[model samples]
Target chain A: MPTKTVAGTTVEVNDEGFFTDPSQWTEEMAPELAEAEGIDTLTDPHWTVIRFMRQEFEEKGTGPTVRALGKTSGVTVKELYQLFPKGPAKIAARVAGIPKPRGCI
Target chain B: MTHRIVILGAGTGGTLAANRLRREYSTDEATITVVDQDDVHVYQPGLLFVPFALARPDDIVRPRQDQLHDHIEYIQSPIEAVEPDADRVHLTDGTVLDFDVLVVATGAALLPEETEGLTGPGWGEKVHTFYTLEGATALRDSLAAFDGGRLVINVVDMPIKCPVAPLEFAFLADWFFTDRKMRDSVDITYVTPLDAAFTKPVAAKRLGGMLAERGIDLVTEFNTGEVDGEGGRLVSYDEREVPFDVAVVIPLHGGQPYVGRSPGLGDALDFVPTDPHTLQSQSRPNVFALGDATNVPASKAGSVTHFEGDVLVENVSRFIAGEELDASYDGHANCFIETGFGKAMLIDFNYDTEPLPGHFPSKVGMPLLKESRANHLGKLMFQWFYWHALLPGRDIPGIGPDMPTTGKRSPESESP
Candidate 1:
């Protein structure tokens, strides 16, 4: 296993062909990895909220709540649902490349 | 023995395959027969740029049969059934064409009616889709006549033709309105079901920034529940409302109608379950499909089709030769996206790769996933290449359907 650092998180890559550690994850990595997973198009508006969440986590050192992220990002809860079908916590976790946040449940 | 090759739908894939195969094989060795309901071959991608008046309607479209080889018989009729086991195609006109090999290129069709109230009261009034030639022309007129209000360019769902088209329309709308000095008057919002203006991350980040720069409103994750024409509102199932004075929507797309008529031909959307690499139909050995008709988890773009065309032509020939099928479609698809204001963005990827920031084909070629003046010129030049080289079954010297690893920046591997 090769251990590396991304966004200041200790990332591990297993021989099972995984590249980086999941803990090193951030919302910024979601769109990039998702496309590698076969997402064809990644347009602009998706970045607006993702970037907002990335900045929030960086400032507070904790994931922002769906309500808080939505408010700051100018995205509504309903709209956020459509944006992240798996829910905000899951999206943030995927982007953050970490486990789902505790309060997300 | 002249082997019979039956093709369904005379669209890009079918027509191109016919021409390519004819050039590769002698007429005496194999006979090609193409079946379709109409003879009109609409250059679908041109539909996106049409509303901007960049493409003349007549130039982008041609008779379906006109592009094929003269030796290939073109039957203008709808397909009623496809017997994959028998390698046969039954037309709506009660004619059944049997073949030693069957190629299903019956591409996708737009079904705006799939969305509730989308086609009802707002049919052509205030709600318009530029996915069709008729819709594009009408929207051009509507846009030209209007002083401006709330103009929304929306995508009803994912997997629509030319994924970046709606955004292009918004960018161009900005240019269009600014040219008229009505840019500030008309609020241009791009409404999409996905989280961002785009589906990928890096590009989405850059594009979102572009939208902000251009003052185009990015309305994300809006799954349209209903188009309330009288109310002039697009309501999501969750009760979010997007009010628009003029809406340009890219509607839900479905597979060819003939797929619905034939058993085991397609899924609910009429897209065939295809081997992601070989472009062979999962149902039968003799049947192969590509482009928008296959549910191969690839972009439904012409570039994908062009690349798939190369793989498909080879696979079809291999099937005829009874050789072991080479499952080798690297899922290479590249597209030139018009970003408006004399520029465009180009992206290249395959099944496992996300479009990375690098030079394409080589460091000398167009920039990948980056907007550049040269890329925009390439986009414009493609129209000439499309009519003269691509359709005529002539291969470009430098370009191949497979994505080139050389001259591209790979995060995974270090330089040798």
Candidate 2:
């Protein structure tokens, strides 16, 4: 088990899986989720989409539309869809370590 | 008695040396013999573009024995080991070939197994490399069928055959998807352990900028630790992860197996340590090395081999004639980077000089240190030059083995 800080979030990862150290639903948790997913290398674009997803989760407590996510991240809907096959709602939410939104199965 | 010259590994360097030496020395004066395990000599540079459908396999491969001249004896056999003290070579069949002069050109090999978990369940399914003929062909099918997802081009380590190849793959991917109308569907990423897109900082900055402009994600300083294929992830040592739908990995490379068999022949990486300037093996004066086998401070590209071949041919001839070997190889290297969208960049430099801005082969010729349509044409035209002029021992009209430093601009002294 390794406890580390990722993108300003304190995360704990043991033999089971990764979780928030403070257990707060925030944008900074994206790096930790990225780390858990084997995505240590993050460009500004990667962080942009990640941070946007977190903000959307915080504001509405739900994942944003793929178009809105792409607009915020300077990517096309297709491009965003390419990065996140299940859509920005699923990937961004997962990467931000936020719980899956309601009505978005 | 004729000068019995024994050449090992009848690939690029071996075949070229044998043919060049044959032209230089008559049959009565010197007898040339080339030894290798297989006769299938691959045009390695073409392998890079194969995955993108830019080149066909047949276009890049040819019979190894057919490339050499008629007088030269091409022995198709695996080398068991080399007895440096006895000035002899032991073949797998137990035949010992004694020679007055020996040339070891047993080039490098791809070792995908060297990287932990690289050859796991994900291999051939989602993970592939274009470095080998089969790997490139496999990737072609994978790329064609991939509707949309993360396509990562990762270079596991450095000292690869062609340093610019991975970048080329990224560039070509952009073009490949664009042609298929799926450019928007695929998210391309270029990952490397280096701090930049290239080894040289200037070229790195330039190429990195190009990667950015092309919407390709550049992930530097990510040393691949383990590949979790089932999970579609690449985990680094620091527990950083880069997930991919399809991962194109250029695995760690090493010198030929024969190098390890020959005691004190190679370093841990299986590369022979030689005087960079002289191209003479550090172990023995009678033995010489060239191409990817030597640990020369240059890109392991064909141009470097062509340049080194000139100096090596001269040095070998000098050594045979009882003359002092001139240690004058300048570590010259030149490469034409194929940046997709019908464009390419040309860079020429030596040990002391970095790739600077200006014209190449003289101020009146091709663009240097800059990408241009003309340079792209030059790159495409090189395949013909490689076969007709370069390989068959026929010299190019103006270009010499040593890099021409005159017309190239200095890094510090910027030209307007």
Candidate 3:
């Protein structure tokens, strides 16, 4: 039950720093989380995917698959990789304030 | 003087290399000796199916002496040290064998202690791995008790033997649960340190899609710093955690301990630094390494060992004859990926080409880069081929060390 101070707000995190609970997520908290994943700033494209993923999770109880996101979010698999290098779905779901998505690898 | 070619380890690489070398030289011309810690020779790939009950533990392992040629002398003793400079290997029982040529095929070993808390409390209970005969056998018992909940398979690091085995385990787990009618209650997740589902992009995309279709979860780029087995959590350095009810892990792999005992003979990880193409040890002309024992960028698979053994045997012959060594190994390797439900996919490639779609080995042979029951049968048939054809060092017609491009489609030619 470790806590990390993200964007001047302390949040419960595991040993690695991912938020323990997504319900406690706030819009202002993304900048801190994104920075830790090695992104300098969240741009329009990043927000487009992030917001789209969050909305999809809220409505469907699950986030979009990478293939689904690429087709619907106007981002190609290559472009999504550029936006989120290591793993887009997992990182975007985290930045968008959702629990880790299934099949994100 | 009878030339001595001492080979360390009597597993896939060592066993086959010993047999192949025996074929090249007569008993009067050269003497061969194979040394191992024990008589056990486990078909490592078969361990992948043991937990799923697809394979019996007793069926996978055979005596090392049974697989080797009678002409080859076998030594059962622990390796204390290897003196590369003096051209001798020290055994724990105080026997030192000198060699004119040496093949260091003692392959990579699992290092569970490298990751924090992996071997601690609940290690044999909740946390299990199918990488060894004992682990796979133990997992079979542990899995029977698992009614449901999160079953996580984590690859602690890369460069493991039969790299696709973990994914196959996940795919087979999906099949196992569905067959048991508990598929709904069970949640299977694959956590890897890599970004993609696999190493190569083309294959990763295909495998990733299969994972999505099967409802198996994938957690990527998770550099696990610790395994909280008691708490049932895999905590990564990035602070991301994947909770688990039953855990199957692929621990970090490293070369055998004797590699560390010999200076300038191996890399920091104890993997011998070889001319990747030649399979010759970078340190000395008389010394050579192949299979998982070498830092060869090639897949640390038995198929790679099979193909490498083709070139390695020839190189050993040339070395003994005082001729310029040939760099014949192309890093050529092929594998059948079990995707479950009586279906599998095959991939064939070398250092240059990624896995391409079409027929393999021949124009009308099994399909590549796609799943079919034929590949599954081919995967099953490989066990027979391994013991009978591969380990006996008999070269199959139309197959060699270098990769063939006749039957595969070039990536650019496809419609995107």
> How do all the candidates rank in terms of lDDT, highest first?
3, 2, 1
Candidate rank order under DockQ: 1, 3, 2
Write one digit per residue (lDDT tens) for candidate 3, span B320-382.
899988886888889899999999999998987888888888798889999999999989988
Tens digits of per-residue lDDT for model 1, B1-416: 88899888777788788899888789899999988888788888788777778788887888877788779998888778887777778888999898998998888889888778898886676889888889988887788788878998888766677777788788888888888887889998889878787877666877889899999889887777688877888987567899999998888777887787777878645778789899888778889998888877777888888888888899899989998777878878788877777888888888777677787888888888777899889988887788778888788788888888766666555235
Ranked by lDDT, the better of candidates 1 and 3 is: 3
Model 3 Cα lDDT, one tens digit per residue, A1-105: 887777787777665455567667788888878987888899999989988987887875577655457657887655787788766777787687676664311
Task: Report the backbone clash tally of model 1.
Answer: 25
lDDT of 2 by residue, B187-237 (tens): 999998776888786777788999999899999867676777789989765
lDDT (10s digit) by residue, model 1, range A1-105: 666544455567444324334435655556665454343444565666666655665654455555455446777655666666545544644554543332210
Considering TM-score, where higher is better, how would the candidates rank from best to worst? 3, 1, 2
Best by DockQ: 1
Please tell me which model should have the higher lDDT, number 2 or number 3. 3
Error of 1 at A24 (Å): 25
Docking class of 3: incorrect
The C-alpha stretches of model 3 lying farther than 4 A from their native spots are A1-105
Q: Model 3 reproduces what portion of true contacts?
A: 0.00
Listed in order, the DockQ scores are 0.03, 0.01, 0.02
